[model samples]
Target: MEKISSENPSIEKTKFIKSKGLKDKPHNYCPGCGHGIVHRLVAEVVEELGIREKVIAVAPVGCAVFAYDYWNFDVTEAPHGRPPAVATGIKRILPENFVFTYQGDGDLAAIGAAELIHAANRSENITIIFVNNTVYGMTSGQMAPTTLLGQKTLTTPHGREVLRDGYPIKVCELISVLDGARYVARGSVTTPKNVLTTKSYIKKAFLNQIENKGFSIVEILSMCPAGLDMEPLETMEWVDKELIKYFPLGVVKDV
Candidate 1:
């Protein structure tokens, strides 16, 4: 066995492995995908909070399918667009443990819209990490509910027409309007600065959950280079100009 290093220790080494919570497998997300960064942030937060053994992560379908392989905690796979409901069930049964859900835009904003809205409206004691890449990645680059207008996708070859496709759904803003949510923030992982800020927001969401602060969701504006058909570097620019224009950034609401 290779010797472990004490210097620059990671959550996997210091907390997860020590607590015997997560398994060992490299994540399966695509390169340049923000889900990996979000996963690491969640793992770090759970480790830092010393809750690796008491946290349960509900993994949703879509690109985040293998979340259980990455998180060093108890994880259950939820059906597509049902993470909120699944997380609610887990939190309701095990109130003492920390419960969180990892879901993508397609999973959370599309088919799972009702589950997500109801969970938040009910003030379910769960933390949600919502990744909004604007496209249905796992389903072969289809246009998602969060997809920006005039953006070309496999489903919208000429570009998403506003009149036909309607407008892109701003989930953070939508959830913020709900009375049950205690915190609602939109963040990104495109840069070092943004990643740090995103991590802080994620940690805060987890802390809110621990405090029983009701439903908390952090919507992340992530890049899907494969679907966007842009170079990795160019995708960040697209996110800034196009994605942020529609979704914007910052905390939409906190109560």
Candidate 2:
């Protein structure tokens, strides 16, 4: 029996290396959390675009508050629900640099609602990666602004009631109507195909910023197994079957 050599052409050897834009550190995200996947996608995109040196990401005060530890670039912490404001200031001062914000639903659609709206209205040349997991992962399993109508969370144990909870805010659709929002789309990470699609949306957002386009946002529907109090597979199923019903996928606006 002859042993196969690693240099053999028929072996089709493949090398897997960590993204250059990502730090060689373990992420603090919970098991089966989508944050890690999204982080890798962002890191890969930045490295591919060759913009890692000019990137400055504004970290939100949610689950990804310590994003600076994982990303190998300049990252600044912002007050609760104030990433958009902080990113705006950074972009204004360093107009030549690439600026973006990583925010969760609670930070973007709840306390930071005004900031999000005004930023889109002003057509700020920046990219926003909004992660919507229905519930706040860092602060227990509380219902978020984008919580589903029948979702059960720490605050909505009896499932959300439309009369009391109103409706889940659709970030992409709401911002698509603003003239300043040149690009708006929603993506998910429930399956491999969806993951690739989400990456494409994120890359498009970054490209828009590189071309000096106005406000661009990619709202990503993520799975939070711990926050939902469900198994990892169950959370993925919920996102694909139920959540997508309320917030459909695809591009909502592109100008």
Candidate 3:
């Protein structure tokens, strides 16, 4: 530690700092957004596994579409809801590479649902990092396929109606049932402890591929205060009190 004069000698210094897997650049995410935290978690895993240079991330349209700008690694952009299909081709051509898809609810659970389901059912040797923020964050706070039953959005101004809007899709639960998926889990980034656990889940998902286990995916519950029109703390509370009740976080399935 750099010891200074007696004026500041009482303050203790931090001994261990977490790995910064991202580049030194300003992120485009909102102040309270949880994507940034998950991004670091993913990066940390890549660095720890010594696969930074071998990673090929497929990013589709969403708030995190500019993810390539933040991660100091190889990343390819796909059309809306086409990351899984694109990732499949890349992984097949370069089987030695660590290929993964980073998708939001709108990109993964909505239009890309077919691609995601088919990919998992085929037991593709790739990792999927899914971020479920509950709404179409990039398209001006619109209602997405994963929006909660009573959640309000630009389309559902007076709370989502189950009859008219239908129920939110449980992505992990749905994908876990597939025979090809060996590892499927849902985690949250609402707190520090949760963040650490989520990172562990991500690591396991990636390792499953290295070990030739099968397809794996980790869906993360993240906050989007910008789209929710709530303060950061308020958003955190909503995630704990409401969202968790619907999409309970845990290891949905593991083989």
Candidate 4:
């Protein structure tokens, strides 16, 4: 067997290319957190589209608040639940540049819901990367807007109640109904196939903006092992076996 080592001749022949849109450094995400994966996907898509230089990203006030540190391109911060509104202004002002926002479920479906809806209603030419982990990961696993029914969190000790907490918000479904929302989709990172599918969804969202189609969003169901108090593998299994039943997967709209 060929040993994989730096001293090995074969190892020297191999090339490890990092995404041009991503900085070469360690991220602060927890082990098994899907933020890192989604970040790479966004970076790869931006680089592959050859728009890294012209891309502008809005960072959400969630676990990924430090997203600017990892992304090599220009990134600006937005107030909690305000990325969509901020992105709208940036895209309108710099119509020639590619703009996008990276937001968590809490930032998007909860506090930012109004901004997102209005942005989509106006058909803002921007892409949105919505990561739904079903909990407020940075806030000690509190119940988020997208938290599944009956799901337990720090705030919901005995699982969520439908009458009390209401049903989980389905952002893609809600946004797809808007006439200005040209594209909306839901994807997951629970498996290799799903990961690739999610990347394709993100790429499509970006392309839609380039074509001036309208507002585009890709809601990614991601795993948060630490927030869920489960092992990485177990959290992944939960997403596949339980969470997906409510969220499902695939394009909700494209027109």
On the 0 to 100 scale, the lDDT of residue 21 in model 4 is: 82
Worst 10 residues of 4 by lDDT: 1-10
TM-scores of the candidates in the order shown: 0.90, 0.94, 0.93, 0.93
Cα lDDT computed for each candidate against the true fold:
0.86, 0.93, 0.91, 0.92
- Candidate scoring better on lDDT of 2 and 4: 2
Q: For residues 214-237, what per-residue lDDT tens digits would candidate 2 score against the true structure?
A: 799999999999999999999999
Model 4 lDDT per residue over 1-255, tens place? 335565678767867578888898899999999999999999999988999889999998999999999999999999999999999899888999999999999899999999999999999999999999999999879999888888889999999999899999989999988999999999999898899999999999999988888899999999999899999999999999998999989999989
Tell me the tens digit of each residue's lDDT in model 3 across 1-255.
235633474545534465656888889888899998998999989999999889999999998889999898899999999988999999999999999999999899999999999999999998999999888888778999999988889999999998898989999999988999999999999988799899999999999988878799999999999888899999999998999999999999999
Which residue pairs clash in candidate 1?
none
- What is the lDDT for 129 in model 3? 95
Model 1: per-residue Cα lDDT over 1-255, one tens digit each: 135543445734643333233346766666777777777777777877889879888888898888777766788999999999999999999999999999999999999999999999999999999999999988778999998888899999999998899999988888888999899999998887798899899989999999888999999998888878787789888887778877877888877
Model 2 residue runs over 4 Å out of place are 1-16
Compared with the true structure, model 1 gives a TM-score of 0.90
Using TM-score as the measure, name the better of candidate 1 and candidate 4. Answer: 4
